[model samples]
Target: MKKESRQKESLGRILKYMKKYWLFLGLSIALAVISVILTLYIPILTGDAIDYIVDKGKVDFTYITPILKKMVVVILITAAAQWIMNVCNNKMTYNIVRDIRKDAIRKIEILPLKYLDAHSYGEIVSRVIADVDQFADGLLMGFTQLFTGVVTIIGTLGFMLSVNVKITAVVVFLTPLSFVVAGFIAKKTFSMFKLQSETRGEQTALIDEMIGNQKIVQAFSHEDEALESFDEINERLEKYSLRALFFSSITNPSTRFINALVYAGVGVFGAVSAIHGGISVGQLSCFLSYANQYTKPFNEISGVVTELQNALACAARVFELIDEEAQVPDAEDAVVLEEVKGDVDLEHVYFSYEPGQKLIEDFNLHVNPGERVAIVGPTGCGKTTLINLLMRFYDVNSGTIRVSGVPVKDMTRSSLRSSYGMVLQETWLKEGTIRENICMGKPDATDEEMMEAAKASHAHNFIKRLPKGYDTVIAEDGGNLSQGQKQLLCIARVMLCLPPMLILDEATSSIDTRTEMKIQEAFGRMMKGRTSFIVAHRLSTIEEADIILVMKDGHIIEQGNHEELLQKNGFYAALYNSQFAQS
Candidate 1:
């Protein structure tokens, strides 16, 4: 019962998408009716022409000629109608698929960060691209085959009954057998097809992960392990796909066999009736044609039933993604900060990615405008999590973080994020030219402004050496650029914005020591009159900060200037000494 309900819901949603194209749908249906009615009329004309031939030489050419001519015209009109109907179906199907993809992408943009973090990128792509394509194929088949098949069946049955009641009864009586066989197979195949779709998604995700990180897999000598994992997923996909195809394949042949029986029944009974002088030879001929036409649709409809099951399964997966809960909206009267002074304060803050994990508890901090504060923490010390909270990517579990004397939660996320310039360790660049990437934070930046920002980040020298300089197009994720060059471009991006507040989370980790010193000097000039939060692993880079924060296990264990912390010989002193000892 639950499965039936879900199928109905999936179909209902699909119909809603089609509702906007009602004009095209109506035209297609009207064309199907005209095509089927005229196609059925052709056999009657043929039967009439046959009646005019009593004996081959004695046939009346004058009477049969007009009927033959009429048959030709009817065939031409029927073919034209069918062609137009198909054009309508194609237009409607593609437009519906376009709308579905648009909705899926828009939903992804508004989805919460937590949801994206939990799902694989490959799985999401599969839902939006692969599943939508499957749905379009199924819908197109339903439009072309299903509608015409149904109309043909109904038209032929009516014409058959008009010709002779007894023969028509035989066709009707045996028709239910075809339906019974098809229904049983269809019911059994839906579950199998559904399983096949899920397995395909898993396989796509596994392949995406392996291919995207092929360098890492080979570097670690895990090629065999990667292949083994892929094989496991591939085997599961094969099992489910074969099972689905097997059941669906039976529907067409099984119905064809039953249809053959019905045709034979009509031929036997009509022959007996004709010999007894109950009906003319011409009438018998018409009945046989009607019987053939009637049973042909059963074969087509059986095939359509199988395809529809697969389509519904893929549609269900896409609908599930579209129905996911979006992120909570901002308050109705959210404030928009325009001129931030960079005064940030956090008091009694509590947060954890998961409940009961107890990562950050009662955290407190205060920094006035233009303070250069550096944070040094071991791995898994909530350094990045703090950045996420301040950016409002994830709200705190409890507490208030204020920027420029306004609670971060009270301000719109757009305005809050735009007030700060951030550069992270993991660099991301879209597929575009170097100038486009540098100007991402400020799209309307002038050429002089863009070049100045790049020079300050020490990326101008490298940019000029490229074949096209700033006009050179970078590959996806900046794959064409070296690691240090990519990092410089990212830094140049933040420099272009030059917001009132800055967050540098290991911003120079990939640069050489010489470039690092030059970039550090640039950073010193950038940080002179702005509030900066620097999260660093190297203790030497942050010795000149106004205040140094040493964190361990999500708590701020030590806080002071460099000399003050070293003289105290606390956790900060020990950490500072350990780094130099290793060097």
Candidate 2:
């Protein structure tokens, strides 16, 4: 999109959020108007005091007292009005920011898996935190100044014109030049600010990656390499930031110079009129004050043009994220999968993570209810990708995967996913008690039920040994627990879910031999009478599976039970023998 159109769209989105606070906004504007009027009256009173003293050619206490008193009262009222205006503007800005954050967060939930996969988590987090904060702060400063600045301009001009039209005309003519300068600099700075924002996100992503993998960096002795990489990113951010700020900084000086010319013009022209008797000395004083006030807003806006540009760039990014296409909608006739039987079938399925890659083509599979199917493959062999397709995280390029004769695509995602329980290689645990984490899959599960699930997954012993048992709060990502223990807790969660279809992808890969034996026993009990799909690198784990399929390059090269696959001496046999030899 063109920058202008994008900015307009972003601004329109911002205004939509502000629309809900119309009453407060109106009150803010009303207070600004009153403040501006009261403020403008001060210069008039000052001019009146000058005229009175000049006429008498002496200090007249009686005459000057009321004017001074009224000026003080007006100043007090303007101060009060400004305070109320600020309160309203702050309330409106924060409320709008709150809504923006809510929508952004909600959008992330519904976004397609592909989008999240392609973007780094740190970049998304930057948009949620740093970018949003920058936008909100800039908007607050811009709107507060914008409202009062505009009122000051209009009111100052009216008073100036009433004092002397000729001087008012001079000031008005020179004012647009200030905006022209500001606009030119703003145009040059915007693209730089955008680059700066992008660079900042990259820097944040690098930091996040490094911090998350600190152990690996230290173990590999790659601190120098990491530091060099981070320095490069930091330098890039600094370069872009310097260029953006340089261009933005030009606005203030250039506008100030233009303002200086307008002020000089008002002084000279108003003095000429006063001497010619075309306007009184008092009127000339008022005209000069009005001229300064009239041009001051332009200078004020110029001063914050940098902030405004940063806000716009940040807002554009925020709006872009909010407008990302969500996951494809469920079919109109989608059914709610319930009481699922374990049968699954795939017919002539074709899929690829990206177009033309052709990972899986013309694939077909059929498994009876309550069967255990083990998929064995090397890395990047589409092992987990197949599971992703089964869960509808990504729709197939073509063909259908059905459960119990119903095409999976015809079912709502929530319903389809609810029918299956999954435990993956990477474990995810939040900062909650062990019991709470296990109960996540079935929140209303009873204490007895949760304990039963924990015991079945072999997590009960560890829970009992913990300082506070199940009540001990897990730290972020279960840092307090071992990798094996975290995996067990995750398995416990799946056990509590009790779905008809179960997927175990490298569930025991990280565990020790002893733990694996216990987990395998737990899995054996859990897999009974349920459809199970196991993806594993350990050949021994799947020896008793009803069916074993060896995959290569997205194609199933060999299949059958453990004994049958070894007899074929095909891909499966080679894979099994290789792991057996290594062990």
* Cα-based TM-score, every candidate: 0.97, 0.95
Off by over 4 Å in 2: 54-58, 275-281
The residue-by-residue lDDT of candidate 2 on 250-278, one tens digit each, is: 87788889989999999998888889999
lDDT of 1 at 371: 95
Q: Any runs in candidate 1 off by more than 4 Å, and if so which?
A: none
Residue 309 lDDT in model 1?
Answer: 92
Top-TM-score candidate index: 1
lDDT, candidate 1, 270-386, per-residue tens: 999999997889988888888888989888888888989999999999999999898777788989999899899999999998887889889999999999899987899888988
lDDT (Cα atoms) of all candidates against the true structure: 0.92, 0.89
